[model samples]
Target: MTISKDSPDVSVIEDRRLSCGVRLLVESNPSVKSAAISWWVPTGTMDDPDGDDADGLAVLCAGMLERGAGGLDSREFNDGLDRLGVIRNISVHDTSTRLSASLRNEELPSTLELLADMVLDPLMPEDGLDPVRSLCLQSIQGLVDQPPELASIRLNHLALPAPFNRSAYGSSQALESATIEDVRTAWRTRCLPEGSIIALAGGIDFDVAADILERRLSEWSGGSKEMPESRPRIGGDEHVEQSGSQVHVEMAFDAPPLCSSDELPFLVATRILGGGSSSRLFDHVREQQGLCYDVHAGYLRRRSGSLCTIGAGTTPERVSRTIESIYEEIDRFGSGGITQDEFDNVMVGLKTRLMMHGESMAARAAAIAADFHDRGTPRTLSQVAREIDELSHRAVDDLVRSHFNSKWASGVARVAVGPSTPFQPRS
Candidate 1:
């Protein structure tokens, strides 16, 4: 295993041809006694609309894959995992589907082989289809039952351009329409060598894990790498309705990509405005006014731009006042920015958190993969800290003013999910 001097704290081995064109990253962390193995395939809901089944296909494939594999039924496989003391699970996000497990170092080889087998050779049983479809449908229905989650999903739909405006989890309509063949086809196409990343992090040796993966995956390999697909950006159509108890508002504007240098100041500006409980929004909306139960804001990302949002759960009666307060803070920060003390504190807080994140090998591996996906290499903690340290209130304020302007703000959308009226900003 070779680790660059850039991130000496973690050793990373990148295997480009572990299978077909699938890439593998093996990271060693001596601090933890367990191993975390993660497989990231570029088949998230975002890829779904392009294919026949769209996002639902990847999800169904994930569900059916786990039902049986490697001469074991779901329960039998799960029991074997339990006997091996392995913790296994899977999840699908907007951009990828992930299968992960953590186990004692002693079971690393068996776990790796089993995982490879499952990813490539699932039974995709016909009888398994209806239950998986029912489960996905229920999950979507359940999202409507939770206020915060429903509000957030609606906010994203309003904020981002289509088809990402759709749920990260496929919509009920799409999931219901998905066929078994569509699910299987999506797996065959998207989970190719080039678009997939396998990451193993923790106490195990790299050579041992690599050999196990190579052998199990070699015969199954015959595909080429895939270039990642492009998704929509932040700006889009806007919609709002009066139908909830608390006003759920989310405003997104275009900002620099994660790889851009401007990201430092932009992040700082966002933090000072609404990054945490101590931020301006919380201070004004919650502490001083007593109008809102929750109010703090943060950012989201894309390859092209980012989003800064302020959300709160407040009465329809107070929604106007609350949004005004939020805008007031935005204007104040844009005009004068924050003080050096404020900037220093936020920078320190964020840096401290980043440092703490390094303690986990799983975090390290995920970070490395995301960085490689975005910027080709991970930024060292010191590099990130230095960028934060050099930030001036003026620079960040400019960023806020540039990206968080009204032209963009008016495009801000709201998705209220209770008994409140539509919130209208004061002129």
Candidate 2:
């Protein structure tokens, strides 16, 4: 599975499938002495069984993996990696769980074995369960004091359907009631090789990496189960009243999915709206009107469906004005579209980001894995840059009109966390 070289500077991408069903993607760069690896499986929060007590099982499962594996205690396992100078991270998303690490290229073999053990032979000890469960519950409880995070969570609950709406931290009730057996069951059911991908970037030979992975994971086998799908529930207002001087408001609108043709256009539109300090939202709402402490909009690219979210932190006294101002900017953007100058600037910015990611092995490894998971094919940095360059101003403008015109008002999901909900219905 050799992918043709797409760019002069980019190495050829090698995609392979092991007998056990684990997919391997490697981008070898002989110029560097370090390697970054990303192990991805379809064991995300969405895989948790439908029950209040199961909300955070996926997260708990990931945590338990780090506790011990292959008969080694947590301390011994971590010390082994430390001796190899490995930096490891594990995160569970809505649709996937990613285990990643960066280490010297020479330590690849040992690192691979350790990672395989964590995934395939996790101990999930009964004693470890209570501590991790308590941590997860505390994380959910900690959200109460974080207005912005609370608002984002509430927005997702209101905008997305069940399971897909489940948070990475799960809920307090779920964590409290979840037993060790429940987490073990969820892990066995969801963590399979068929839907998993292992990505390696930086200084490593593709053949060597593939061989290492095959030897480590070939005996591990499990069938992958499909996650339940649901459409987003857009256009509604939800308010969680809290005692605070500042109000946190989050607005979400439907956008193109990862598989849609309009994905790039929507991403460009998000940047123009609020990608950075120079974006319309920041320039208008914060810099000009001085209504918000901070404001930004981002395009969340998801396999189920994409979303454009705008969030603002502002005084309760100014929440209404801040929301109205955001709406005004959206309307203006929909009607006016973006200018050629803005297009060029955004294109440059996007390319700059792509180039920077090219320099980081970790970023490249994670990117290829995510691309394969989301699109079934890995993309080169050059491919992404070309796509961004090809996007015309007119096409973006058209997308903005279609997704953010008067339709934005009708299709928006609003969540406010504060002492009062000051926003009124759009007439």
Candidate 3:
């Protein structure tokens, strides 16, 4: 275990790998009276044994973990957490399934016990399985009316490499075929200790948290799992026919993955393009042209790479122009690069955003766990601040210039969900 201190009075960050092969990250913020815990088990969809057939299994298992555990049924378990005034979320992502909770410092010990049992001794009750599965199925069915969400899902499916591209929503066939026994097996096989991360923040002591986890997870031990490499596919345009007055469009272009040299530059670039009302997308498309109510760009990071995604919703009449205008803005921005004034402004904005994010104990805790997954280490606010401070104007501009030459234009993926096919009929 190594320790890193942020300041004399702020928080102390510690990263430790326990004998059980679980990594524990604790950032003790003595100034705050609450604590946040983010636990990641390697039980995400990527680890599904049925491969594509296992899409929704990881998500369903995540939901069932909440139903009961450690001798308590669903109601009793939730009642326990409620009594502690703990706010928690359990969700499945591409990399892993996570249990995140924030509660008062005094409730830390008990909360950890309940959460630990969720991962270690979950009941996976047969009675609860149907409800959880139905919820999962309902969520997938609900997507039909959610064109924007559906468009994003379709875009990710078309753009990202296989397995990574699979939706967390289980396919209908997969969800129906998934028996309770299979979910039990998935949990047992995938919820290993080696590759998991337990991150804690706010009013916590690293040694104390570690002791609690070490005892509770003493019997939890196993090696991690890995997936095979598949051929990279250059994603193209896609359109889904839906009866809607407004067309939802999503476009994705290349960006660097976490731990890459260009990660910071790309972050700055995308932020400048569509991060907020202050960005180019909002300025040129929404406000100036009145093309849509919203037009924004965001950076989506996966372990393999990243995407600078731009989305806008507008009428059928404006859909084509909206898409062309977005690309025009992208081309102009890429061709001209960014001004030093706006670049400097974006730098400050990022620094401020980072500081603000650090204020929330839960957000900070989730970030710590994410850093461990992405970079194999946790970074303090000051460390991240220094990285932001070190970002150069030349670095960002040069990266943007190089991007347009190959990746963004050639492999750009566009998806539109509307009555008309602005993205073509896929013929």
Write one digit per residue (lDDT tens) for candidate 1, span 92-183.
77667788787887788988877886888776667788999998888877875566677777677666655555575666667888788887
Give one digit per residue, the lDDT tens place, for model 3 in 89-113: 9888877899999999989999999
Q: Order of candidates by TM-score, top first?
A: 2, 3, 1
Q: Candidate 2 residues 1-427, lDDT tens each?
A: 1121245545678988898998899989899999999998877988777764568788899889999898899999999999999999999988889999999999998999999999999988999999998888788879889989988888887777766877788877777888899988888878888989899999998887788888888888777677687754545898898996889999888778887888888888899999889898999999999999999998877776667899999998898899889989988888888888877788888777787888899999999998998898998876776677677888988888777765565555889999988767657
The candidates, ranked best first by lDDT, are 2, 3, 1
2 against 3, candidate with superior lDDT: 2
What is candidate 1's local distance difference test score?
Answer: 0.68
Best by TM-score: 2
How far does residue 363 in candidate 1 sit from its true spot (Å)? 1.9
Ranked by TM-score, the better of candidates 1 and 3 is 3
* TM-scores, all models, native as reference: 0.87, 0.95, 0.94
TM-score of 2: 0.95
Candidate 1: which stretches are off by over 4 Å? Answer: 1-19, 50-55, 222-244, 379-398, 401-408, 420-427
lDDT of each: 0.68, 0.85, 0.84
Error of 2 at 41 (Å): 1.5
